[model samples]
Target: MNERQRARRPGGRSARVGAEVHQAVTDLISERGYGNFTVGEVAARAGVADSSIYRRWGSLANLLTDVALTRLNARSPMPDTGSLAGDLRTYAANVAREITGPDGLAVVRLAVALSSMGQQGVQARDDLLAERTRQLQSMLDRARERGEHAPDAFAVLDHIMAPMYIRVLLGIGPLTPEYVDGLVDRLL
Candidate 1:
């Protein structure tokens, strides 16, 4: 294989350290709330030196932003299941799984916290929303191209995404298969 054909990974030691730092930030946010933890605490929890985080992420807020973005956006590519219903069902279910994962609540909380954290925080929040919207739009656009009925992305966000996220965030209900399916069915 030629050089350009080789897969380049920034993982190895750097990725491990980054994951550790992200997890440390998530745990600190989960346990002590957003503004309550210091860089030293995170470094200790992540088993890396404080200077490591500072050098990599620059500050607590930057690290927190990275954690929130990485956790919240971690997912497989959106499903292209040949129909709107199939895609919606798959997408909604994936979201349900994510927001209900072990660190789901903490990640959600971190995202919410970041939204109120000032200019940089607001920008991070915007970037996340735009990316999610873009993903949803691609699915919807495919359905439309296939000559099927499809609602605008906002409708999906309002009717489906909002409820599941709210339920998870508020700890009000399980995002069971039935609940997730019902949301998709209602959208269809």
Candidate 2:
């Protein structure tokens, strides 16, 4: 096998290091909140050299963006249950669990905090939102193709997702199954 093939292999040292670094960021954010630590601190927590993070992710904003996006993608996969209503409920429930999971709030906070760190931070936030919108659009498009009545992706964000996120962000309430389903039902 060539060097590129070996590098592309799953569970390689690179992947392990990347995962460790991401976890370190999450832990730090959970413990001390965003902007409370530095890249060096993250490296120490991950047992990696600070230069490695710089080499891989370029900047702290970039690294934070990567962590947020990676966690979001890894957790909330777009659901497809044929009916648009079913898909929205399932997707919202998946998201509810994700945000309420052990590291979910930390990752969510990381994404929120990224918005105020100046140009790079704002750009990262935009990238994260764009990725989410693109994923939702795919599901909505599938519904449209099937001749089902589907609301706009932004509507899903506004009606279903934004409420859940705000509830999680503000510690307003628990995301019960009924609540998630209700959001979907109201949207439908």
Give the alpha carbon lDDT tens digit for every residue of 1-188 in model 1.
53322312375877788788878877777788887888899999999999877777656767787676665566735799999999999888888887788766664666677777778667766766687689889989999999999999999989998898889878887788998999889888
Q: How close to the true structure is residue 164 of candidate 2, measured as C-alpha lDDT?
A: 92
What is the RMSD, in Å, between candidate 1 and the native fold over all Cα?
4.8
lDDT per residue for candidate 2 within 63-180, as digits (tens), equals 8988887867878889889988888988999988988876657656666678768888888778778988999999999999999888998999899988998898888788889999
Give Cα-based local distance difference scores for all models: 0.79, 0.85
Each model's TM-score? 0.73, 0.84
Q: Residue 95 in model 2: shift from native, Å?
A: 2.0
Clashing residue pairs found in predicted model 1: none
| Over 4 Å off, model 2 | 1-10, 101-104
**What stretches of model 1 exceed 4 Å from their correct place?**
1-9, 47-59, 73-77, 100-104, 169-176
Candidate 1, residue 57: the lDDT equals 67
